[model samples]
Target chain A: MTCTAKKCGIHFQPPSIILIYEDQNQEKTRKRIMPIRNFSKFSDCSRAAEQLKNNPRHKAYLESVSLRQLQKLYSLLKGHLKGQSLAQSLEQVQREEAIDPEEDMNKLDDKELAKRKSIMDELFEKNRKKKDDPDFVYNVEVVFPQDEQVESCGWDAESDEGF
Target chain B: MAAAGGDARAELDVDVDVDAGPGQEKYDAEENVKIICLGDSAVGKSKLMERFLLDGYRPQQLSTFALTLYKHAASVDGKRVLVDFWDTAGQERFQSMHPSYYHKAHACIMVFDVQRKVTYKNLSNWYKELREFRPEIPCIVVANKIDADMKMTQKSFNFARKFNLPFYFVSAADGTNVVKLFSDAIKLAVAYKQNSGDFMDEVMRELENFDLQQKGEDFSDKEESCPEEKPPST
Candidate 1:
């Protein structure tokens, strides 16, 4: 399968579900193939897919690699359940498009670029002054903490050299 | 044996379709088992999973940063089992894994490169992380990249012995012990599911919570933010 990226055009095998089973009476193992349904058909991908395809920013970053991964994950999730729940879970991880700093470069018009530059300059000026203000403090941490039920484990010890 | 069957019956109160015909029905043995792979970057953990699942298909290393779930079916002792191989990004950044990734995992395969002494040294840290969340789940220690010139056979054996976890010397590139490792994992998972009384309950609870999260009804503040931002080092 060719990647969805128009520029990349890399040929890659799309992920699919293949079930290998054994006949109870027979000794040889057999296989059954299952079609991987399109991700867009699922209810959850509707909004995310639209955003992924229509937005040039997203398309640029999503790339063929990410698109393939997304499809593979979606197929695995959808294969297990008939409900729309898997779609919802996927939408959770579908991140918003980043605000590109070079967005103005795409427009060939000079006036538009100048206008964007002015806005950017104003925001940059505000950012610089805000950091120097004595009243402003970056207090994202909590003073008091309670013990929470969280589990983390590791091996007993480490060896730099193989024994 | 009857008691074991009875226990299994109670635990499997899943809403599996009952009306599907005999051959058409998804067999009880055909249940989905989630198996997680943990190892240092480039220990061939992903390759091992890909080789086992695709069975002779070698995929180009995409070097995924986040967790990627690969689904495949295996016939173990006349039972068809759907295995979900969760290939984690790497072990150096254990902080990336959400606690839920370990929830209800039927089995684990912790891998290390035979040539890289550093990867083998980090195995204990991986074990500790896994045991913290899943204290009782069966884990296997695999010495991967056996095709490499540097062989640590005895050391790998000793490490496996220390944890009492089954060990396999595998070469994912050449397809050595890859099949055995996966089949053994599936068997261990099936046995673990049969024996663990609350295993299914935990899985069900996690599944429900997953559905709730999908619906935006999850009120828990502890949800992982910025999940999988750091990709595994190539």
Candidate 2:
């Protein structure tokens, strides 16, 4: 359908009529269903792309990705540490020192911390192969500008321009 | 124009006074019931809602360019219920819906064009998508475009029956069972809300038991704390 704008009477075609199932005489029905093209074209794709790119969900998804990575790292580190609290662990180390002064608790703690860090690094390295996997689908949905918010984006309301 | 109206309502933030006349108090309060429409493209999901809301069908008019909201006040079970029908233009080509679209949805209407077997085949996909968000919400299956020659067969009825959902064969063109379908949808939504309140009570009882168990308290203590679930005298 042609936009009602007097000066810019550009024609915009709606998405093609999709008929997955129909009667046996499909050719006649197809001809009847198709809309006639009047005007040549209108360029709106670049602007639509820009709008899609700058959607808040895009930014939120990016932020969520990093946050999720950090969370996974935190969990892995916790697992490696055997659920020990710093204070309780320090107390245990002091008690161990009392039993045997020659064995350095600080050295043991540092060694343990390094071991956990290495384990986390190795896990990250192992999963890095799946990073580029085509099957790995991200849980993200495209968020359009709200109807109220879309008004400020130069979208002509009546004709549904810049869709 | 719809966007402007929606924006104006958003800005007001107060209950819209829909009562224009004296006896309109029967339809007073703004109890919002959100109903989402889902289906394959060209299945008349938009047309069905448009017909229901406007009481007229515009064949050439594509009512949904974006998420369109239709607000109608219905006197459901003696209560004024402002039902918000959200028409998500079935195809997710340019923009996929944010999770917020299903947020607080009270009911769903899954439409499929009876003429098109593919649309009928995609019913489960739509139902699954709806359940992912609003699991407990009541869903009604609608076989739209029944006016078309190649209508849905007995198998369609069985499909809806399998899910134990209310199903209706509707025609947006001739307005066959359209009004009753929407009215029934509202009634079902009201009933769902009522049942959900009771469902919450059941949840609270379970939560209280869990809390008591966590605290190492006796089961008898629930009788003292959860007075709401107290047995009645026979």
lDDT leader: 1
Cα lDDT of model 2 by residue, A1-163, tens digit:
1111111011113412111222243332221122212212242322333332344643322221222232232223233255555456445534422322122212234444333334333333343323146653222122222222222211122333211
Chain A TM-score, structure 1: 0.20
Instruction: Please give the lDDT score at residue B16 for candidate 2.
Output: 35
Evaluated at residue A20, the lDDT of candidate 1 is: 42
**What DockQ does each listed candidate score?**
0.01, 0.01
TM-score, second chain, candidate 2: 0.65
Can you write out model 1's per-residue Cα lDDT over B167-188, one digit (the tens) per residue? 7777665556777888889899
* Residues A54-114, model 1: lDDT tens digits: 4564443334333434433443354334444545645543422222322313233544434
Name the docking class for model 2.
incorrect
TM-score of each: 0.43, 0.41
Which pairs of residues clash in candidate 2, taking residues 3 or more apart in a chain or in different chains? none
lDDT of 1 at B144: 70
